[model samples]
Target: MQMIKQKVGARVRELRNQKGLSQEKLALAADIDRTYIASVESGKRNISIVNLEKLIIALDTSFAEFFEGM
Candidate 1:
């Protein structure tokens, strides 16, 4: 589970960077807290499905695309 969280976090970071979005930017777009984004990226938070969906939408990406190579 810990590894899964880290993997997801890494993937989120990759996508965010690919989209040239900062943590605060992404958080605002996703309507989540910036600290939450930081925690998620640092693998300290296991994000909920609803929040993940919000983040994906904010990234303008689909779940399949987001989870690719994971």
Candidate 2:
């Protein structure tokens, strides 16, 4: 589970970077807290499904795409 969280976090960070979005910007887009986003990206948050959906939507990606290689 910890490894899964880390992988998800890494994927989020990768997509965020690819989209040229800062953590603050991504948080704003997702309507989530910036610090929360930071924690999530740092693999310190076991993000809920609702919040994960929010992030995925904000990242302009589908779940299939988000978890493509995972």
Candidate 3:
């Protein structure tokens, strides 16, 4: 589960970077807190499905794309 969290975090960071979005920008777009985004990116939080959906939508990605290789 920890590994999954880390992997998910890494993927989020990767996509965020690829999209040229700062954590603050992503958080703003997702309507989430910047610190929460930071924690998620750092794999320090077990993100809920609701919040994950918010992120995925903000990132302009589908769940299939987000979890493509996981």
Candidate 4:
């Protein structure tokens, strides 16, 4: 679970960076708090399915696509 969370975080950060998005911007896009995004990126937060959906939508990806190659 921990590894999965961390990998998800790492993937988010990577994708966000690739898209030239800041944590705050990504949070806004996901309709989540900036701090929450930071916490997740820092590996200090457990991601819920709702939050994951937000992120997937924010990234314009399907869950499978979002998690692909991660």
Candidate 5:
């Protein structure tokens, strides 16, 4: 679970950066808290499936594409 969290976090951060979005921007777009996004990107938060879906949507991506390399 810890490993999965870290991988997801890393992927989120990577996608966020690739999209040129800030934590605050992504949080607002995803309707999530900014601090939560920070924690998530740092691999310190185990994100819920619902919130994960929101983030993926805000990133303009799908789970299949997002987890492609993983």
Candidate 6:
């Protein structure tokens, strides 16, 4: 159950890479820290709902859309 966040994080990372966006770029677009994004991608951070929304928006996706294949 808790692994869902990690999965979501991984999916986000995959999509970001697929779109040719660096962690720093995504963080800048999302108004978040690059380290934070790195942590999430590495499954080292348990993101808050707020931060999750920031990532979703940065990826230009909805939560449901972002999580569809996750």
User: What are the candidates' C-alpha RMSDs?
Assistant: 0.8, 0.6, 0.6, 1.3, 0.8, 1.3
10 residues in a row with least lDDT, candidate 1: 1-10
User: lDDT tens digits, residues 1-70, model 6?
Assistant: 6797688678989889888999999999999999989989988788888999998888888888886866
Q: For residues 1-24, what per-residue lDDT tens digits would candidate 4 score against the true structure?
A: 478878888888887898889888
What is the Cα-based TM-score of model 5? 0.95
- Counting clashing residue pairs in each candidate, in order, gives 0, 0, 0, 0, 0, 0
Question: Which pairs of residues collide in model 4?
Answer: none
| lDDT: worst 10-residue window of model 5 | 1-10
Q: How accurate is candidate 5 locally (lDDT)?
A: 0.94
Report the Cα lDDT for residue 69, model 2: 82
lDDT, model 1: 0.92
Model 5 lDDT tens row, 1-70: 4798899999999999999999999999999999999999888998899999999999999999889978
**Cα lDDT for residue 20, model 2?**
100
Residue 46 deviation, candidate 6, in Å? 0.9
Q: What is the TM-score of each candidate against the true structure?
A: 0.94, 0.97, 0.96, 0.88, 0.95, 0.88
* Model 1 per-residue lDDT tens digits across residues 1-70: 4798898889899999999999989999999999999999999898899999999999999999988877
Instruction: Please list the residue runs of candidate 2 whose C-alpha ends up more than 4 Å from where it truly belongs after superposition.
Output: none
- Cand. 1 TM to true fold: 0.94
Please list the C-alpha lDDT of all candidates, in the order they appear: 0.92, 0.95, 0.93, 0.85, 0.94, 0.87
Please, what's the RMSD in Å of model 3? 0.6
As for TM-score, the candidate ahead, 1 or 4, is 1
- Which candidate number maximizes lDDT? 2
Instruction: Give the range of the ten consecutive residues with the poorest summed lDDT in model 6.
Output: 1-10
